[model samples]
Target: RTRMGQNQTSIKKEKLDDLGNKTHFTQKQLKELNKQFRKESPSGTISQDEFNEAMNLMGVVDPFLQNLVFKVFDKSKTGTITFSDFVNGLSIMTKGTQEEKLKFAFEMYDLDESGYISKEEMTKILESFYKLIGPSDDNPLATFSGKKYDAPQQLVDEIFEQMDVSGDGKISLAEYQEGAIKNPDIIQGLKLFSES
Candidate 1:
């Protein structure tokens, strides 16, 4: 029985080491993250509804943004997030480089994985954003800034006019990278994921 227990311990350690190799987190960090994930999802997988509840607890209350994030994290398209998926996606959002994060951000907008962001795609994302941060009496821009806010369509047109350098009517990945690097505000505006 002691030998069997030792074998089980070694197997668990091996699994953690494997995940450590795949993610940016250390073994200890992975363990902690897994503990948190399991605490939230005891079945070792999180359904979309559970994910939405967790995001709401994290203060991410925008249903549209929450849905987009869940779609991005559910890479396997199984409509559920496993521990591995959660860790890998969290690693990218928390520890990935600027370009890597931008790539993930681009994926959120690309929608069809077509390697480019069409105007319609951008419009959908921005419309969701506008729903969250749209003009309101509490919005400073609507109050003190005294600046006219562009509608979602106008915003998408302005973004394409600036980022679609190839004039191909689509914003390619390269154009997105360049535009994001040049305008930090663009990255801020595309804040579906928390960079912190």
Candidate 2:
């Protein structure tokens, strides 16, 4: 049994090494990268130097509507973003008939159909968003601007709590619509689509 255990551990270690090679970043390297990122964007506000630094850090890549995304997520005047902020940004970016989109989002987030989105409901929504946006094994987002990824779970919870203004544990269609309109990306997308 001891030998078998050792063999299993070795196999797992080998697999981890293989993944590291494929991803081209060791755990320490990843930590350093994240540290560097935080050092640069600690307050979330983009300085010109930071902007240029990010360009260099992330490498040349296609713009994935990042400026619009940053504008939407930088809520609370905080320099750093949480997961909730990211999803709220996505909610705003989603396009459709305003009423329809709001209704759908509210329904999806309102797990209990209590006509409001609770923290639990919002977590699920954020998870869904991560699944939608996270780097897939087959294809990944361009490595520009550090690749816009899904929000962290804790951040998602915070965002849900903040958005539920009435404390009713749910967000109504009106609230959702209002939030959506506040998002510049969604508004721009809607406007461009309308014009086209």
Candidate 3:
């Protein structure tokens, strides 16, 4: 059993090399990445608890986004993220093909995994950004009349108009691709490619 596990890790290392070549990360970089991953995930996979720790290390305060990131890396739909999947998932956002990056972003925003990023989810994500930047009076999440908001309806409307091509309240994967293509800043700001 131990030998089988070792072989799997070795096979994963070979795949990681292929991934690194495509992403321009040399063997040394891949080695360092694996080292760091092992520091946090010595078993070659990271469970939800370990993922939370990693998120905390990244100074990620929002639980929602943290979980979304975990989901992205757990491509096998398993509860934990293996080292190979972790490296591959990181590449998807940082230097993978355009389609891979867009697919990742789509999953990132689709908090519910409902196959679409609903207007409510969009509003929540936008509100989270405002919170991170220190909300001002104009920010949707700011208390209005000494009370929290039920929803940021206006912000959702504006976002829908910009990206919801089918007049649906949610953004589908197709709509997300078109919107990202239309707004280069979305790609650049999100670091969807190494060039950005």
Candidate 4:
């Protein structure tokens, strides 16, 4: 009886330790997790295949949602989004309510706060967002999605290029904020993404 009780206590102690470790996420870690979750979907340059894959991954197969997403990406009204258009659409989709989302957009894209968003600023924001959400050394994408793929670097670069308007290699906070506000779906998506 004494030996059995000791074993039970030891097991309980181990379980408690495991729970404690799992519950503690630093701010940086949480930010990274958010970023990784975002990247699971194609952001700036989403091929039709990639978009479809993202829909499947997110379990959002509703026709209405699909149409809405398609519309968002159809920036040229050309009925099909090119790689650059797809990326821009994804960035737009990540936006939220004008008032609330603008704060985050400004902070993220405004490196100089010159009342304008530059291409470099946009690229920096995208890179940071990708880094924060993309798989890290400690936490790989497979761990979260239970699937494997090539490294996310290519996708990240593609997104940055798509968002960097003016061909100047940057995007200003103002630009981001304006884009975000224009798309209500993106704002809604942002809320849902953050809550999760």
Candidate 5:
């Protein structure tokens, strides 16, 4: 039993070293996060249902957005996210640079992973966002010109207009990065998790 415990300690040390190098966190921080993750998911990985529960605890009640966030964390597409992936994603959302945050946001928006965001994809994400936060009376798109258009679609169109600088039908990473940097609303949308 002592030998097993020693081996586990070594394994954890190795993981902490590896994850520390890859993430912008100290060894202590990683250890705490690993402990928290283990408490939430004793199996050492988080299933979709477990993820949904965690998101609910964090006040992200929209299942679509929760699933989207889950997919982003499950980088391997293995139907579950390991602690390593979880911490990596958390690092990006919490401590990563602006460019890194924007890239992560771009990945979230690029639902199909086609390296671009289509109007439909953006609209769907916007719809999910509205569902998560509910309709806002102060929404800029609430009643433009005294008309109640589909706010999600209007937001998508506005975003596409700002982001599709090449006049292309889809938004590439470069365009997304550039557009997000220029637009505070885009940046806010990208930082939804952190800001929320």
Candidate 6:
């Protein structure tokens, strides 16, 4: 796949422009990420099926999020991702600035690139999360300043309330970014990025 927005270059140039933008990544992170990437595809390229298996093995159970990730990384939309594409995608996910992270998060949630996240979309995503990590003992709640959740719906409701700045029940791109900036961890929860 062609890169999301990048000039074609060699391995050295890929490392130099690790983020696909102006942001560059550290050699150590690049080396480690590449090592991980190599384990998945010895040919230095990853197809859609292989990418799905890799994320599933990594314990990412959310299918929707996994699809979103594939799209973001597969810039060319050729159903495959090269080493350079992987590195640039990884750098943006892990080391990009907050605005970058917010944009990525918005894209993931936007679904149709409609520039707005409707209640239906939000509900679907939230249900996926609830399925992955509910309030059971295996998945205790940690939101609300460590308060336990009464129900999964409460968490979803709270997010909608805080993020729907227009009171229209739908979150616009601007509203999504503002909410993500206010709660940076929300963007980090995309699972492509590390907590650090």
lDDT of 5 at 153: 90
Clashes of each: 0, 9, 0, 18, 0, 1
Q: What lDDT would each prediction earn against the true structure? A: 0.79, 0.47, 0.72, 0.47, 0.82, 0.69
Best by TM-score: 5
User: For residues 1-196, what per-residue lDDT tens digits would candidate 3 score against the true structure?
Assistant: 9999999999977877786766546778788888898886778888988888876776666777777778888989889998767877777766677777888878877988999999878777766655554545544343332344444566566557778999867899999888878866456535512432
Which stretches of candidate 4 lie above 4 Å from their native place? 1-97, 135-174, 184-196
What's the alpha carbon RMSD for model 5? 3.2
Give candidate 1's TM-score.
Answer: 0.82
Whole-model lDDT, candidate 2? 0.47
Global lDDT for candidate 5?
A: 0.82
Sorted by TM-score (best first), the order is 5, 1, 3, 6, 2, 4
Better of 1 and 2 by lDDT: 1
Candidate 3: C-alpha lDDT: 0.72
Ten residues in sequence with the least summed lDDT for candidate 6:
138-147
Give the number of the best model, judged by lDDT.
5
Q: Which ranking of candidates, highest lDDT first?
A: 5, 1, 3, 6, 4, 2
Q: Which lDDT tens digits does candidate 2 get at residues 1-196?
A: 9999999879756754654543435656544544564565676345434443453454412232233234334455465454334333333434345654455445545656576666666666445444434544322221112233334465444444545567676667676667556543333323321232
Predicted candidate 5 versus true structure: per-residue lDDT over 1-196, tens digit per residue: 9999999999989989999999999999998998888887899899999889989999988888888889889988999999988998999988888888888878888999999999999888878777765677644333333344456898677777778999988999999888867776666555565654
- Poorest 10 consecutive residues of model 4 by lDDT? 140-149
Question: Residues 22-53, candidate 6, lDDT per residue (tens digit)?
Answer: 44566666666678878868987888788888
At residue 12, what lDDT does model 2 achieve? Answer: 55
Q: Model 6, 99: alpha-carbon shift in Å?
A: 2.3
